[model samples]
Target: VASWAMISNFIDVVKEGRGTFSIQGLGDPSGRGRMISFVKAPARGGDKEAKKPAIIAGTKTDLRRLSMGKAEAILKTLGVPAEEIKLLTRWNRINLIQRLSTAAAADGSKLGDRYGGFA
Candidate 1:
């Protein structure tokens, strides 16, 4: 089912050269979760912009919590340098927040006035 598909994708990503990955939720408070690892793909190709790494954000309560460990192991097995593996614990939700703000603004109504917050 969906699990199988995700596993397949993970394998494919590992086989590919130089990709960034982010794992989330090893441990955190506030019930907000945290990022566990940041895998930086090796430098390849001439295009600097193309070198942008991939991100795999995970949360503590996520169903696939074990994925973080699995991903790290696989990357290591593939001979990815140790320096490429970094542990991080931040969730980047700016995109979502910006989208919500944009939508609210587009409605031509002030958020505080419409939602009854501090003016």
Candidate 2:
């Protein structure tokens, strides 16, 4: 439940349009970065939301694995620009993850300062 709350708080921050959860400098040789992203992806909703805890607690997925459907849902959720959404979604670029993950992680005040971004 703790992990769920932390992730949910992060999601709430992104939903508020306060900040973004970047992925540029987030990845690494270890896997904490992956944990953050792993948790972030499931937080998007639908069937994914239910398995958020297991996803975070269990195995880790590829750092660069994300579907087109997820891209559209994220762009729409985070309020990304309309024209750019198509291009970004088509390419499934890293910037989209950067903007999205940070958006998910930021919590307005401190998290906003540390992880908040839309670029």
Candidate 3:
């Protein structure tokens, strides 16, 4: 079982950072995989809010390499194992902002189909 401290640490790291990002997975039938890219979101709430947001574009590889790819790279850099990620099945949000906006376009360099069709 995972410890609460580990989970709390992950949350704290994300809270202190500012940016948009993505993680794409690709692999073959054997489950060997590679991740394309993990773009970070643009800096927000600063002196200039007009700057283009930071977004992870995509990289391509065989589906089999998905697990070993970009998403895994992110985890490795965070000193966590790839298998520790738990997929999100639902979302319930509470925010103070009354109106917010999300970027609708993904960078052309990224793959459209594999990563939720952001592009």
User: Against the true structure, whose lDDT is highest?
Assistant: 2
Q: 38-63 in candidate 3: lDDT tens per residue? A: 33323553466566544433423322
Cα-based lDDT at residue 77, candidate 1: 43
Give the candidates in order of TM-score, highest first. Answer: 2, 1, 3
Which candidate, 1 or 2, would have the higher TM-score against the true structure?
A: 2
- State the RMSD for candidate 2: 24.4
Clashing pairs in 2: 20-102, 20-103, 20-117, 21-101, 21-102, 21-103, 22-98, 22-102, 23-98
Name the runs in model 2 displaced over 4 angstroms: 1-63, 89-92, 108-119
Model 1: which ten-residue window has the lowest total lDDT? 88-97
Could you tell which candidate, 2 or 3, scores higher by lDDT?
Answer: 2
Residue 27 of model 1 has an lDDT of 21
TM-scores vs. true structure, each candidate: 0.18, 0.32, 0.16
Model 2 TM-score? 0.32
Every model: Cα RMSD to truth: 27.0, 24.4, 28.1
Task: Please estimate how well model 3 matches the true structure, expressed as its whole-model Cα lDDT.
Answer: 0.32
lDDT of 2 by residue, 1-119 (tens): 26685577577557665444444233122445553431222233345444443342232533245577665665666667767777763556556656565556664554335334432
